[model samples]
Target: MTRMECRRSLSAPTGTENDTRISTHENESECNEIPQSKSYPVFKNIGTSQCLNASQEVSDTGQCCHPSLMGLANGHCSNVLEFFKDIPQDVRKCLVEFLSSGVTDDLEIHEGNFHHFFHVANHLNLRRLLQCCVEVYEKGDKTRIKEKIGMCECVHYLEQLVATAYRRETSVLWHEKDLDSDRKFQVLFLTKDKHARKQPVVVIDFARNFKIYKQDIEKADKVGVGFCACAFEQDGCPYIFVSGGEEKKKSQIWQYDVILDKWSKAGKMLHGRSRHLMVAVKDKIYLIGGQNVACIEEFDPISGKCVEIGSLPVAAWSSTYAVNNDTIYIFGGKNPAGCISTVQSFNCKTNRIARLGDLPCACSGSRAVVLGDFIFIATSEGHLIKFNPMDGSSELCALQPFIRRHFVMFVRNERIYITGGVRKSNDKGADENHLYKYTPETDTWSDVATLSTSLPVYTYCTVRYSGKCIIVPFEKFR
Candidate 1:
């Protein structure tokens, strides 16, 4: 209902900043300093009188020959108590206060401490501590901790550390014949320290056999036909936005959460559109030409509202378009005069549109995909036209084996994939569904796989998410 100007800020630090914010004491010794042999700390089990050596080499399995300071009689041996003394005095004091108070408000750690803390935990086999950090990082709620730290930094460090530790432990276990295959060893130490703080340890199961199988995926919740969809990720979750289709060219919007495998209503657009082009740049989704409309609208997913940004110089429908950098290139489409080969460019930063050169020929209902600086347009006549928007030069590169119209195309892993397009039948003389793959390096086209049903030929949208191709079919209108 109201127009809002979209702006982005660049206030965050460019490189790694302090995430933990743990106070540094002027009197405390350096964290990197190795303790002298004479000054090495002595660790003792809570109930045992004998002290354990700090430099005692822990087995690859973390089993200690002598009793551990945590009072484990014959379990995994760890020198965490000894290593705990090596941490900066300020850090040690904060940790002690944190443990004693049971309140995070007084204890503040920076994100920069994540790497150091993780390495220390791995060296000491502090499984509970690692799990606590993992939970805090995953939840992304700084308030859950007394002092806020960088959740992303902590989570990234923990993932890398865990993966590396898991690999190393597996390698050692595979080579050791004396270690029983049935023995359940904790790669991530879940044992509690003297403080009694314990958390669940994620065990690496080596006995289970993993297999990969190709199976048909269940259909997503039905949405209206003729709508356009775009894929993007936010807050570590993948989502697909479907908008402006059937239901009388409704402005209704819906979002599919890949993680939850559920669909929910997003806000409606300012104008109902079909056969439109939607491209996500940063946080905003740009809705381009559709249904004979020259007006362009910008939809903000965060605000759940669309605003009229600008208008196209020429009204067109079913035109092939692609975004390169901050500019959007619109190619051939049908206009009032019929099929038009006009090409135009819209600068997003300046909100201005300028005329580029026309295509080699009119290509209504064509699909355009951008790979690097080159824009490839697949036309209904089964022609693959490569055009450079910078110099306005166009050339016909390769021809498709089967002519197609109203098809979906996208680029993934540097290869172009096309599917669900109508093709002339060889025997029955009726239009059939077909799938194709094109590689830019060899400038060639090849047939990859086919679909079970021909419904995609009628109405469907394709998006690549999490290294997998997801095809969402539109519900047919009765």
Candidate 2:
């Protein structure tokens, strides 16, 4: 029911002055009361009257307006029309019908035709139609829309439309200028170049069709033997902290800024460690058992310092763990007596350790990931154990198809993905390059895809970045 008024000065041969006005309505029924029924009127100051023709071209810019006018000022033209040369005829008809009736009954917008509608409506200056297109874009699925629109295409146009329509910025599409939080969740696999000895962190945007290419991502700086890595967020920025590997005396912690894509020395762990586990709870990192060190240390990213919080009651190392409710669940690991089926819980709040129960078997080199209320442990013996932490009850969930040790386990979209492990055998296991997917709903496992390279056991770590699985491999991929 709202009407739009436009005023522009016009020069005529007789020096006559006049003003033109435009009226538009949300309801098409209002147009019936005008002198010309079902037709839009375009009145000019130069005593010219014309009916708005959607298909007619009235300007060199290929815009439609009063035929008598040489040009129209920005927003001064009553009717903004374009031929929609590239658009399909049905789509063109839909747009023209919307302009005439202001009804969207036949305006079917979807992923396939969104770009066409957006370009046509934007070019014609149809703000209402453009707003509709933006709404469709906003309500789309994040991963799907990202794949369709790409990361950079038409983002500014959408931004401008949102600003004009809503008077505020909208997070409709991700832009390079957006904050790190706006970026998509990514998975990173750190691999070393054999020739140059440089570590190139492989970034995986799993949501973008789960595509991986080594040449597409830039190379990270040369790093030492990285034992384990964990991602932590500090003051709204994301970072990956890598602990040194193998050298017993190597305690340097390298911090990788996810936003800046740069690496530098964050600090050193309290003790030189290898075959350790690093987990982030809240803002602090807990580094547990490495090599001969049985003490657990807490690292503060802000202070760049590590403090010995406590130590494991028994000698335990090479075990996989997961954190829930501020408690670290340590599964079976090796001791002076060899592999033990010990399931222990360490409370972060009280800094206390207690024995929960024994794992199904003495799993020395296994991987564990938490899906829901249960912790799924993939043992090197080809057994998948499901452990319920609430009552410390454990049972075998399923059998792994591949009997592999030193593998990486991660969860995405309520499903588990394991990649880059060494095949368990008597003669020093061989590296595995296949990625396997486990669906808990059906208790099934399937080999989905093969990785570009194999990720060895202690050489890689997994963390969730923005809720997406990120695998940080610290070894050279053969």
Candidate 3:
């Protein structure tokens, strides 16, 4: 299914009282009192026998709280609130009791109080209370609530809110599942700019309609030059381990604390490697290949140490890898001669390496990701290869837009995204600001968003976490 986008139909929170007053008429039932088994603590404390009047603003604050409540206009409640004086005393009492402390079980929902409570709650943006009102209305005479809601001044907004509440109440589980699946993972993009004072981090939140934000390292943390980073979670906290550098920074690994926004030296590789592939499997991280090193070493985040488990059967440089269970599939890479089509699999459990099959063509400077039973590889040649390990079958589809090599690719929520790495007209490697999203289901590509800065090739990785909004909004959202 296509991902759901979050859009605001109504104005954003204004931090003030709702100014839309409908001048509703007081129902005749307002004069009648209904005895309740429960007592109103807030009402008693405020020295009031009934809920606050609709036109009554809390003191001189010019704002209202729960309809059944009064005297809460102080800076206590920040959410938008409204009151309808025309609602009956008992219905206002129920609204106040429900909205005040979020108690709905004891609120007597009879025919006399249904229409008033539903309309008031819907108007006040009390979604929970409106949902309760919808449940009660659905159990009784639905036609009456329909007519009552249809008669509201802003019939469109009123009926829309009513239908939303009704749908939410009926398919709550389905809605919850859809939300969880769509927004569960957050994608983070980091740039490799050693000259910058602090590292630039881009956080993408799919929950908020693919919202993008920027952050700094906050502390004196900077990624080393010529670094290859891998995003992994340690102890339930997201982290990015960056390795590879030149001179003094070589072989050193840095652990970035995503939560604290701090960076510290984590560990060092046994061999300083460049053009290598780093992947996280379970709790351990595997650093494979290098310009010359053929050994594959495993690094333990907890111990902060690297140990060489085995060596590649055929050492290949500039190779990419994808892990499935205990096995890691090493894709095409360059050697001393040139790019090689050799494919190899290393089993972490067995500590063994075996040749799988050759690629349709050598794919140096490529990226690979596993989706279901197939592995999708995006080559620098602008070709997408789908490889099936079961039968050793491979199919290549050339990306028309990506006529030149140098783009970066990453997968989130089973969708592939390519950005940056465009060869400029100057015949020089430059950053391409355009971001493209590819969907395997339809085998189609669409430009999604342009980045504030070009994404560096092999210098970015996605970390999943609960993120916050940024001060600088992405151009796409604006």
**Candidate 2, residues 162-264: lDDT per residue as tens digits?**
5555321221122223313222333444445433344544444332333333321233333344367777775444678878576333687888755334467
Q: TM-scores of all models? A: 0.50, 0.57, 0.57
Pairs clashing within candidate 2: none
Q: Considering TM-score, which of the candidate structures 1 and 2 is the better prediction for this target?
A: 2
Per-residue lDDT tens digits for candidate 3, residues 293-409, read 899999999899999998988898778888877789999998899999888998888888888778888888787878888888888777788888776678875473554455566
Stretches of candidate 1 above 4 Å error? 1-223, 424-435, 448-478
Off by over 4 Å in 3: 1-194, 218-222, 404-406, 412-415, 424-431, 437-454, 466-478
Which pairs of residues collide in model 3?
54-85, 68-96, 406-421
Model 2 misplaced regions, further than 4 Å: 1-169, 172-196, 215-226, 426-433, 450-478
Strongest candidate by TM-score: 3
lDDT of 2 at 132: 75
Provide the global lDDT of candidate 2 against the true structure. 0.57
Order of candidate numbers by TM-score, starting with the best: 3, 2, 1
* Position 419, candidate 2: lDDT: 68
lDDT of 1: 0.50
The TM-score obtained by model 3 is 0.57
